[model samples]
Target: MTAEEETRTAAPAERLWDLAGRWHGVAVAAGILVLTRVVQILLLVGLDRAIPDPAGLRSNLLIWDGGWFQRVAAGYPQGYTYAQNGALEGNELAFFPLYPMLIRALSAIGFDPGSAALAVSWLASLGAAVALHLLGTSLFKSRRAGWALVGICCGAPMSVVLSMAYSESLFLALVAGMLVAAHRRVWWAAGLLGLGCALTRPTGAAAAVALAVAALVAIREHRDEKKWPPLVAAAVALAGVPAYLGWVGWRVGEVDAWFKIQTAGWGTSFDFGDSTIGFLSDTLTLADGWVPMSVALILLVALAAAGVALAGRPWLPLAVYGIVAMILVYGQAGYYHSKPRLLLPVLLTLLPAAAAAARARPRVAILAISAWAAFGLWYGAYLVAVWPYTI
Candidate 1:
């Protein structure tokens, strides 16, 4: 082949590459989100049909913790809730304020609490998709990777929470947006987004620390530049989680009130993975329910995935955020079934798969992700529709 022949052959490929470069990544992320949601909803509807006494798909979306969030949207209690036996019980205080606050604001415009909550969650989920795309593109310098990240995250096992009346969507949007801003050295936006994240969920603390790490990295790399902004951004982000925790303590007139409420209400406390290990051991060895065993396997796979992501040497702040988030999820003693949902927003465990998919041929990657979504969407739908316990 001569040079002219090679140039002619390469021109079309070059044009295609240029077209892809001009395509809007956010739109791709949105498309992936829509596709995943459609698949998940279809799965939910099919599963709900097979189950006895189906409450319909909408009701299933609002079941379990949806009531708690709705009550919170109505109003928080003045103090802790207690049983007739005088034992403290879990109450609205255990939940963070940011998510319900948005719900309340939307409800004030005439929408019911449930609709408002769902609206906030769905809108936040869109923001999360866009932000996650930005984060992936920024980290890997590949739009394909960004789209892959969005697709994988939306289709992750138990990711149906992203569509439900839950704070996970809001928290994910804020955290990913913060990371994107930090990576771009937009300290103010990063700081504000980080603060939002910290207020949205307990794992926001991990995000806050991650933002601080980003700031520190920036400061170190540009020693002579204006340092105050990054310093201030780190300080603001670092303060957010503690500030909310302090407010909760003051509201309840006990420094440990939030921790107490969490433990009393949901048996949620940091036991350094003891409970998780025990559950995994029992479920795997004792041959418990399929759901329990599946959850155990998911946990193990997530841990392994995280290790693989770390071995790839991700951006330092992201690595820190992922590590801390995993620690919080695994170290806590809560509903074993809920671990997968909690792991959804961690983002770290999904990175390796996303990157691999991004590197594969387009057809191969699509086929692989479709196979994954088939199982993940069905798994999530089954938990909500067929399983008797909370996700």
Candidate 2:
């Protein structure tokens, strides 16, 4: 090659190398995400042999809630959805708009709906891993902790949703980003990311509350200044969930239309943990299947783990977010198996594991995470491939 040509080729490579060097932690986090995804996808493929679906195993990624998201992306209903007998039915409106809107925007660029949905989810998952790494590093001041956080989260049970046509990936990305911004006292970014989280999922309310706590902490520390930025950020975040809910009500001509739809369609409502307790009781005592028993056990372990995390005295904003998110997941009456998926982003439960892994030797950390990824990936794959229920 000519000298000019060699310079051109090497310059791009050099720049890429420089970029990677500057963001090595992020690169590691991304690698962890990719590793977990590969393991999970392979597990799903292996499970396909036992499940035997005409549409193939990959199709399972878009089953259940994915269908709802796709429907919403196609277009939301102009009014309430009702069953043939005139009963209120769960409609596309029950699904959040941010994810579907992203899918639609991607589709407009000429990709098919399924491809677009997956594309949006995968991209958001990447963003999530990066944001999570930043959050961990910012809070703990350790790159190892950041990487551990990414690995634990991506390899978490039901983390397959990160690769699915679901909004959990987007929600996680926004929530993590918001927390990172809040911890860094970047109020503008925090406020916008918090708003995004609120629009993406109902649990965003918990996140907003967490942001408010962070703001209060900041205000107390700077009592003389009376920082308006923190106050404004909290207010902006607090407005998101209510704004979306109100818009839904206005669109459907009933103030409670969204709640009614959720209850009718998914049997989801806050019951002060009554249903969860009942499920745990039955599953522990007389459960017919191992999956139910396992789920029940996970719920208990998660609660205990969160308690331990609190005892460790994590950053206040993160603790608040984790506790409130857990409340929303456990206090609701709904499909019991789905709780783990919702809990995946609850940093509180993951904190104990992540911190332990961070402190361990590299070989030990890798082995522990490998074992965890093996079971978590398999469990998630089994839920979608063979569980025969909407997760």
Query: lDDT of each model, Cα atoms only?
Result: 0.87, 0.87
lDDT of 2 by residue, 1-391 (tens): 6797557535633443343334786788899999898888888878877755534655888888888888899999988878889988888988878999998999999989988999999999999999888877777667777888899889888898998988999999999999988876778899999999999999999999999999999899867544888889999999999998898999999998889889999999999999999999888889769999999989999999999999999999999999899989999999998999999888889888888987999999989988888888999998887788888
CA lDDT, candidate 2, residue 66 = 88
Model 1 lDDT tens row, 3-58: 98568545643543343344475678898998888888888899999977887988
Per-residue error for 247 in candidate 1, Å, reads 1.3
Q: Candidate 2, residue 31: CA error in Å?
A: 0.6
- The predictions' CA RMSDs to the true structure, in order, are 7.1, 7.0
Q: Candidates' TM-scores?
A: 0.93, 0.93
